[model samples]
Target: MNEMLLAAFALFVAYLYLPTAWLSGLRPAKPMTRQANHLHCPENKFYIPEDAVLRRHFVSQLRWEIEAALHPRPTDSILQRHYDALVTIKLEQRLADMGCLKPC
Candidate 1:
């Protein structure tokens, strides 16, 4: 009786844990891809508080990044300024794309 119980438990464990390829045909999984048009937040899904500190915190980070791009380290070569300008341009373009900044 003990041997029969052990065999049953082993069979149960194998069926529960083993990956059987034949079961794949029952339901094939597909990867989910985002639709190009639905990139922006779905109309009011979340509400961000209009706190002054929070606003200043986010603005300060952006300001610091622009400032860093505008002024490279003294040890860097003059060519680094050109790279910085390109970085700034790309940042502005992305901000424009996200509707955070208005392009002239």
Candidate 2:
């Protein structure tokens, strides 16, 4: 019953936000260019540049701040922590793949 109520509320919220978000001129990002490929790894298929990932995470944090201002949540938090954790794991894996016990 709680799950069903949550699902219905989530769907209603999405329906309300979809048109507002569309009207707010928020659109999907454009494709990255060939010259700007260092930010991503096509071979392994993930974001590669630590700086870019951090920058994106920072921007998202700011977005969450704005959202929190509009609608004050009891616990206002962004997913940057999770993003950083994943990035750390990915960086360690890449280092391991390159035969380094520790990053130089």
Candidate 3:
């Protein structure tokens, strides 16, 4: 009985280690390709005009701020105010996009 239990335990350990060893051997031997540089346009071939890019960036920033405000972990009143300000800014941008408000 003791020998049987020892054999079973050894088999279980081997079963676990065998799959891990196999998987490690099957994994890619070489490193993956490096990530693309997101900060700048690739080779400067494609570009958005400065004014439009600035407007888009502003709208994106406001959208991000609004999202962050919505998920405030501590639920602070100041965060709520920041969210409201971002929403107001987004609304103004929308109005401007529709030509209802002149850009200042």
Candidate 4:
């Protein structure tokens, strides 16, 4: 019975993940040009350098900021608060242009 339960749990997990993986794979990937431009936030005020290494670092930092904002936790330590603040400010300005957020 324990073995059957384990098998069922594993299958359930796989069932949940497989469609997400397949759908992601099926989605058309953004072109490289578009990706290159992604480093430029909506405001166009803050941007990662065009260099690939810098762009990767910027993306990593952005992802950390986004995750932190979405999932605030008492135990979590912010690794890049200053940089994240700057990015957040720039993003807010951009969103304000679209009337999404009040201008600062």
Best by TM-score: 1
lDDT tens string, model 3, 1-104? 99999999998898777867777887788663342344333432433234877868856765676566665433688877776786777656554454412221
Q: What residue runs in model 4 are displaced by over 4 Å at the alpha carbon? A: 1-44, 72-104
Candidate 1 lowest-lDDT run of ten: 95-104
Off by over 4 Å in 2: 1-78, 100-104
lDDT of 1: 0.59
Off by over 4 Å in 3: 1-74, 100-104
lDDT of 2: 0.54
Cα lDDT tens digits, model 1, 1-104, are 99999999999998788687756766678665553234465432322225779756755566567667665544566767776677667656545555522111
- Those runs of model 1 whose alpha carbons end farther than 4 Å from true positions after fitting are 1-75, 100-104
Clashing pairs in 1: none
lDDT by residue for model 4 over 27-86, one digit each (tens)?
Answer: 899676653455434443444456779767855775666556664533434646755566
Task: Score every model by TM-score.
Answer: 0.30, 0.24, 0.26, 0.27
Q: Write the per-residue lDDT of candidate 2 for residues 1-104, one digit (tens) a residue.
A: 99999999999898787776674577667687664555433344333234767757844654555445442333424555555555556555554454422112
Counting clashing residue pairs in each candidate, in order, gives 0, 0, 0, 0
Error of 2 at 13 (Å): 62
Return whichever of 2 and 4 wins on lDDT: 4
